[model samples]
Target chain A: MITKSIMIVGVGGQGTLLTSRILGGIMQEAGYDVKLSEVHGMAQRGGSVVTFVRYGEMVAEPIVEEGQADVLIAFERLEALRYAHFLKKDGVLIVNDWRIDPITVVTGAAEYPENIIDELGRKHKVYAIDAMKEALALGNSKTFNVIVLGAAAKHMDFAKEDWLKVIEKTVPSKTVEINQKAFLVGYES
Target chain B: MAEKKIMLGNEAIARGAYEAGVKVSAAYPGTPSTEISESIVKYDEVYAEWSPNEKVAMEVAIGASISGVRAMASMKHVGVNVASDPLYTASYTGVGRGLVLVAADDPGLYSSQNEQDTRCVARAAQVPVLEPSDSQEAKDFMKFAFEMSEKYDTPVIVRTTTRLSHSQGMVVLEERQEVPDKPYERNIGKFVMMPGMAKGRHVYVEKRMEAMSEDGGGFFVNRAEYRDTSIGFITSGIPYQYVREVFPEASVLKLGMVNPLPRKMIEEFASKVDKLYIFEELEPVIEEQVKSWGIEAAGKEIFTRQGEYSANMLRRILLSEEVTEAQAAQVPARPPILCPGCPHRSVFSVLKKLKIHAAGDIGCYTLGAVAPLSVIDTTICMGASISSLHGMEMAKGKEYVKNWVAVIGDSTFMHTGVNSLMNTVYNQGTGTVIIVDNSTTGMTGHQDHAATGKTLKGKTVPAISIYHFCKAIGIEHVVEVDAFDLPLLEKVIQEETERDEVSVIITKAPCVLLKGNHFPDVCVPVPEKCKKCGACLKPGCPALTKKEDGSIAIDATMCNGCGLCMQLCPFDAIAKEPK
Candidate 1:
């Protein structure tokens, strides 16, 4: 019974919740017990949001403790740096090369750190993809989260068909083709 | 055979209520608990509603219960404070039919003003409480809670935390059991809580508690798992999962029924184990009780009572493991902010320009106290904005509060602010009150309220106009202004403060996040007309950001073309771009 914990980190309204749902659905289809947990309400107002998905033969708690996540799927670079500790020593780090300035940085109270990818690359197995650019290339920036999820899917054990099926079921009917292309670009990158 | 499907804890509770044949359900939307009633409304058999406040919701549920039908009320932990008065009395005058109250506790203050333990309130009110650890238990315990309510003839409480309420897990679905409603009998002694009848009901409540304690051990919900007897853990709710995850080999007494302890089972379990440790979160309700039975146990001493508990916390406590701190680069704090075109942003901008000291209330408007537009001076609780402003004016003369105004939301104004506003009129106090009417409960995900002119089931109703309501409450001067109209809002604020009598300013604007409510145009920066002056960034809209070269650029994806930044720009650099 091998249990794996994945932490999805990003700013609110970045489709992190939807990504977790698709991921959880894929895991459930793979015949593993899965638990997905997230914070709602006040935290969704342009704040840093993190969701945890744990799956195995049996998962006890939905939370991922510090230094326990096997994979860190970050939708933003700064968010990737912020929640890096949750990853295990040999964990795979998949980060989108995008930056959303926090309120402090916008208000001149603090500075957004430089060289985030380089800093994380030195310690962990880092995969940096320009997911937002790829989604824009696909003619929709709203599909950015799916691109990140597609990049993350390459590291997981689930079949590519399972991921596509889950995506088709989760997303709306009209945008399925474009999202599938976004996922493929993310997976190949 | 029942199929297992993935469901959130809140959704599972709603399913549980539906399966239990609940005829009526009422709730005031709050985080974590809001989705329960929302999910229940999908079932056509149940008559569900979103009451104006928790107190009203509780009374509505109680009314249904007394009419010989199963009913339930749900709210967040803070909302229990508003509904406590009726809850306490309902305990004395037991339910005619099964009744359950769901209080979703926020353990880590994830989306709440305070982290409170609902178990303590349940004990104070002498109500039996059942705490569920996962989605399966969330549904199972809800059904069990209603049974316990009917069996003991009392209102049962099902306590959940943010983790359990928001987490998704597999639940085994069950068909609805159509339980027939009991016959309604007009027995005043049992239903009424008069002083004379209350004394007799109090005795009955004590007897009921005694019977429950004695027989609770035989119930299926309370169980003792004896694995390795060397060290035993007595835990319940979400904490039980953490303990099991951390110490899989240790024996545990997982008590689903939190209150009305099963004395016999506890004593037997204690004698079997060499060392007993009570693992619970937030409060030591169980630990204190076990200790009062002359049984020594380790609890709050090992675990702090401040925040939530986790497997890592338990591992650190028992194994003496040092938590590995991340040495990552410093990240800027990402505090929650008002959306790009939030109506509250305009109100806060005007209050900041006027240099007025504003007492804030709960909801999305509380974000006004944050940076750039820091106008709020104090925020104690819901509806405290108006009353606190009146108190300040009375304490430090009318001249001191000439620059002070109380800001509240439309949902909060109806929640309890109406009483506070009437207090100002009755006491003859001179203070300005501003209701930021965004049409819906913005903070809890835009649930319809009394003033929203819509029912929980999406039925249209007559919307209560806030301006007219204020005038009817004896306020002489009531003015309504568009929140985005900066000059008009500023002018109204200045005029109201100069006048002697009490006045109300209703800022009317729908929340930008509401569906189909966004302005079609997006604001863009005209590069040639730009100056490096930082005036446009004063309102702190997340969409407006400074480029690497120091000129401001609006993120077209984020901007809603509210023209607020354009109004602040002296160089006339910001303009609305055609879609």
Candidate 2:
């Protein structure tokens, strides 16, 4: 009935932009007034990054405010923990269960928290999956974001056929089949 | 229904330039503004080129305007400071044709050194500024700015914030408005800026400001929307969107023309509302003006003058609602790091090993200040690395900088480092400048510069050799070394810094992220040979991590086979394998 805001949070270089592009393409094709806000600069160098996607009859603000996100998709466990607060009280959180040590962890200054999924699952509705394992099963680790996006698709307001059509047009020609397969693996999970 | 598409604000700005019949566009690649030229090049009609820096870009646009054609230059806010020399003059001289300068301001410091508002600069130069709220407006305002420029005979600045530039929104496509080229008439009194002519032009500039300010009240870009009179917001650009989101029914005077703010419209709106509030990010450009008119407005007292503002801010401030925010989970911080196998990592690794302090410049090399590779002592701006080092040497003499060197990227070296290099040579200063020649602008996503031998329009030109540029500038000692060859690089850095005269050491390596860059091998960890001593992890390459088994593991996917980790490993625990 109102504008739906989706927040995509992930570590930079983890194909966060690809998933945002796919979502943007789908939203526009669906004839919704969509706006996506992204950060482009020095921050993309493996820092925690976010892309806000909002669509509805009329979208006003580009950024999804704290506690206003209807859905939040994360590509890394730490990033999910970082931005999970942006989700609404009953918002759905689909997260990839993966770990990449930050410089702090490498330097022994901080510890990567344990039981992040369990902690978040107790608060917000959480769907945690090891997307890296799924992508590795597909023989290409880079398609992990497509798998995560597929898992989150069931929560969004789009049909399977619409997703398939957009995916075909969005991805590169050579990787279309693999991305399709990757999306289905998460869709059926 | 009209055909519409979603694009970046930068892209929309480019489309606006194309549709308005712009003939020439020049820019220097900086974040949030780089994509403008990237998109502008797709149109075959416009002759777009990426100049060496922003000053050159501003001059190019001024020259093009004087040649009787609509022209523009785009850059991040700091670049405007470099180009302000010509910008201030262009304001006085006016334009032969409509000229627009698109300055993208980074209010949140997303990718910039400072969060300076371009509107502040506009007020100083006495130029008018038009700010758009969304993608469609980004296009519409560009066209309007040209018309406004030619009508007023003054250069127009179309300013956009990071939120406006990087955001993507739906925009209705439009046909090109093919404006006829203006005839260039010989008017020395108007074009020339000598003392006598400049004095007359100064009066003309003041008159233009007065006229623009009066017209600004009724300008199409400025609008007054009425709903609730109890509270009102006078906002512009992206902040206007927040007012809509937070208080949909509140009366608003959305000032699209930020500079030369509509005084009459603002006063009238203030009279209608019971209480008025001014909302602007970065600097209080709007609030200060509205307040100076003896009108009361509540703004920075409750709102921050730093970073981006949002709907939630207005909700908590104006509405006085107790909004419960979800508690953010505590987690390890993930700061931006150098990409695995980045050539800067290799060079920085050697610098860290030599225990040398570096006067760092911008680019991916700035990340060297982060973790285990923390060798950079300071990072001021683009070319401040060399100049600051010269300052340090001049301040403390040559003996103080015995263990110091200036590290800069190739693109930054071209930007302003060359000028600093000449200053060092002319002033008889002895300092070492390491030109980290990664062959592209690494930080801003690898846009080709002069040394890259490529143009913004994808044309292949004779690449300017950095080595020759250094030698031709009368620098006596200059050398080129492979970035990945750790031993040789270390030796070269040591020899150069020890020298008496000014020297340039060019480290040659292509950025790992560049397209068509292929690695013949991948680095793998030999678990059995691992001593678990952690020497290889000192460089802080993201690919090397400590496994629970007390051994280092290599992420084969991210490694570029640069062998920096292997070179660092005392036990030869890491091996390069064929992919």
Candidate 3:
């Protein structure tokens, strides 16, 4: 049984939790034993948030130890860089080309790396997408996560129809159409 | 037929409570433990409530249990400190029906003030503690805890750490069992805890512990798995998973019942294995007990008694494997911040503007101590703000308190600040108290509280006004002002500090992040009139940022337009962007 660990990294309120849930749902639907772990409370206040999703015949722990993640789905550029260690040397990196400056950077305590994508791309299999831009094209920036997940879905073994079906059940009925469109844009990007 | 679904450890605990025939559930919202009660509320068979604090929650659950119904109360580890008084006494008095207390410990200090272990508290109180490694066990152990509680006639503690509580795993759900409630019988000797009765009960407790210790060896929960038998790992709770992940072939003595130390099982496992290692997080509770029993086991010495444990950490410790270390990046730290338009931002901005040393309390307002504002001097605990301020005046004299004020959140002020304020009134301590009333418990994901005018079941109730409460509590000069009204708030703070008597200034504003609560107006910078004096950035509102051209820009999507940044602008360079 081959177990795959996917680390979803983003700032709080970026729908990272929902993304992990959708991935977990997809894996569970595929009859894979899935385990998802997330951090709540203080970390939800615009801090770095990482969710771990492990799926296979069985998963003992929900956490993805350093260098064990098969794929890294990052919602922000800097967040992708921050959790780069969790990704295996041959891991697939699906990063959103968006930078939300940290408090230290805004306060001039530190600088936001200008070439984070380039640096990550040089070392690993990096797929950078402007998920925020894609979501904006769909008329709702909140769908940015769905788009990122859509991009990640292309790399995964899951079927496209199955991803859409899960998204339909996972998201609200009112925004189903927009979210589905957003997911496609992400998948194709 | 049982249904299988993926659920968080907290949700599984709630499902367990429902299936275990729990009648009443109460908890004060704290991280990791908050969702247990929240999820329990969905089951109509159980009456669930969000108590004002953990102590009140514990007492309420105890009251339900004494009424002959199974009851459960939950809170984060620090909250156990608040609930410990009732817990210790309840341990002596026992229960009419079964009672379970869930103490979700945060070992890594993830979202907590400290990394205190709940198992230590359970040991001190002579209560049996159950630790679950996964969601399935989280559910199964909750039901087991209730059975053990009734069987032993004691309040059982279900100890879980952040990893187990927040993690999601597959759980097999079962039908809710209708356990008949035991009739209430008032026996003073058994129920009441007079010194004489307590002494007898204490001896009974000792006897119970001994019985549990002896019986624990054969209990199915305290099982031993022998594989290679060369390396034995004794672990419980989330650490058990790490041990299994790192050493799949090694023998494991996974003790589900953490307290009362399954002594015989430990001896048996220790005897069979050539090498013995204890893998427990936070405290060396098991390690100390095994050593006292004359069993040599290596634990805390190899694995530091701090933070959390990972598979890599265990592998490095046991096999001396060179775990891959990622090159540390000098990335800017993304510390948690107040939401873009948090009401606390305005209050801190005033405190910072006045150069007042504000004693802080726990909640979202504690973010005020972060960069740009930095007004908070001390944040010891829940109600430490008022008491700390009073202590400062007593130590440094009244003159020193002239430029100082204690700032606490509305929920925190209600939690324990009232008592602290009462102490000030009784002792005639003169220090200003500012209650940042954001209408909800903003810190713990906006759970409704007593002052929020809403119950756990979403029922509207008469909200307790903090302004009136302060006046009623002997605070002569109590003032209320909108948090966004910078001039008025500043004036009130200055006036309140100047007055000799203890005063309160309630800065009233609903948390912007609360659902259906937004200002509807977003402040946009007028680039033509902009002179980047950086004054608007002082509040550190995440929505407002200075561009490379030295002009301020607001992310319209992120900004709720509370207009706090607009009020902070020196020139008329900011205005509400038209919808």
Candidate 4:
């Protein structure tokens, strides 16, 4: 089993924390060792958050080193750029085309750089999608993270079926149908 | 088939507690750990409440635990500092019923006052610590924590790092169980922890640790994989996955029970590999333990000792050849800041412009210490603002500084700010405190609190007024100011700073998100009278964007229409559109 490091980056409230859990569930069920670490408590006010997901036969660290992530899943445009440098040269990044400037940018002390896709593309393979729009189209703006997760799977050895099982096992029975369909849309998109 | 639910780690702990027959739940909403009790209250079976602070919450849980049913309490890491008085004693006294204390550690200082790991607390209390890697484990371990609590007759700690608590995963929900209700069991010798009883309980705790390690170690919680011979890795918590990601063929010992670590498992694993590296985040708790057992491990040497450990860090530490130049850039050199339209921005701006040294407390308000605002001088945990301000003023004298306001959030004020206020009154120092009450915690996903008059489940609870609290604290003057009202806020702050005695100015505004999805109030462009002197830009509201003609324009799309810019506009170039 090849060691694969997945980094989930986004503004708080974008459900970045769930990525590690959902992804870990799939990895753990696949009989692979999974080690994940995330920022908790506080960073919840739409602050920037990053979660590190690593899985294989022998994991060592909880976080992905800068620029060492094999896959970068971003829920917001600015966060994609903020963490863009963490992607390895041969890595893949799936970004949602939404911008929520951080406090520094808001106070006019700094500005978000232009053309995040172009910048990320310079170092690694980049896919920019309006995941939030797709999620909104599906009637839940909150599921954008899961949509990005689906798009992210296309680049990895992570089995689509296994991810579905985890989702089925984890999602509430009341919203299972919607979330299952949501995951399918994300996977197929 | 058991029902499955999509739940966050925070929710899973509540689910775990409910299934474990938890009779009572209490906590103060701190990030990462807030949702545990919030979700517990959703189930009609358990009694849950939000205490004023973590110390109170801990005492309340202890009181419930003594009654012989299951009980649980949770708080963010630093919160444990407040509850330590009871936590240390409770470990010696042990528990009458199952008690699970969940302390969510925020590595990377995400939303906390500091990233003090709670694993240390577990070790210090001489209790068992279960660190769950995911939501499923979070749920399972919570129930297990309670079980271990009762079996060992001790308070068990389910230690969750921020990632494990806030992260959402698929949790297989269990049916809620009912706890046996009975009268309190009064065993003074065991519960009181008197010097005589304490010595006996202390020895019992040591014996319990030995039994738990021997029995629980062989339990599935701590397991080993014999994959390859050359290199062996010992790790636990979230880093276990990262180590596996890099060296797929390496032998590994992944520890689920972090505290009272499996000594037998470690020695066996160490003997198998030619070299060993203990991979863990924050501090070297596991590394130190292995070393104490006469094992030389490599960690915090090749890998970073600060912030958080990432997969990239693991690869570099274990497989150095795999790293590349582009990967170097991916590591964030700087930390994240607050977001635009943040409720804390205006208060910081006022403090910055006045050039007054402010003692800032934790919460979203701590961002005021960052660039542009840079108004805050010190940030020392929660409730330190008011007390620190009093100390600074008394030592420096009131006449020395122009502005010296203690900036604190509404939730933080209630958490420990009450005591700070009382100290300010007793000390009789002339200082001003700005309570930035955004109507929610605002820093930690806007969790409800005592001041909000709402429960986490959105039920109405009694609200505590900062104004009334200030008056009760013996402040001669107490007033409220709209934080977005720049001129009025500035005048009020300026006057309060000059006051001869204690004063408090409450900044009242509902966070834009909590305002119920109405389009944020926007500033209308007065295109005709625009000279664009750039005076409005001084306050640096993101809603105001400069145009090509040097005329300032407000993005009706982005503005919340607070109109502080209107007051700052020298040429009357800005105004708020009618609601």
> What Cα-based lDDT does every candidate model obtain?
0.91, 0.91, 0.90, 0.77
TM-score of chain B of 1: 0.98
Interface RMSD of each: 1.4, 1.1, 1.2, 5.0
Docking quality class, candidate 2: high
TM-score of each: 0.98, 0.99, 0.99, 0.84
**Local accuracy of candidate 3 as per-residue lDDT tens digits, B1-579:** 567899999999999999999999999999979989889999889999988899999999999999999999999999999999999999998998899999999988889889999999999999999999999999999999999999999999999889999999999989999899898888899888999999999999999999899999877788899999989999999888888787889999999998989898889899999999998999899999999999988988888988988898987877788777676466888999988888888888888889999999998788888797799878888899999999988898888898999999889988889999999999888899999899998878889998999989889999998888988978899999998899999899999898888999998889888889967788888888888898888778777777898888788768888888888888989999664
lDDT digits (tens) for residues B287-386 of candidate 1:
9999999997899988888888899898888988886766545678898899998989988998998899899998988888879889988888789999
What TM-score should be assigned to candidate 4? Answer: 0.84
Tens-digit per-residue lDDT, B413-447, candidate 2: 99999899999998988999999998999889889
Could you give the TM-score of chain B for each candidate, in order? 0.98, 0.99, 0.99, 0.93
lDDT tens digits, residue span B1-579, model 4:
776654677888888888889988888877778778778888887888888788898989998888777888899888889988899889998887898899888776656667787788888889889887777778888888887888898888888877667555556777876767546767888998779999999999899888887786576767798899789888876677566667778898988888888788788889989989888888888888789889888977766656766666665655675565643233222245444455577777677777877888887777677665678889988899999888777788887544778888898898888898998888787888889988887765667788889875568868988898888767879989987777788889999888887888999877766658343456777888888677776555555666668787665435666666776676776776664
Question: Chain A in model 3: its TM-score?
Answer: 0.98
TM-score of chain A of each: 0.98, 0.98, 0.98, 0.93
* Higher-TM-score candidate of 3 and 4: 3
How does model 3 fare in lDDT? 0.90
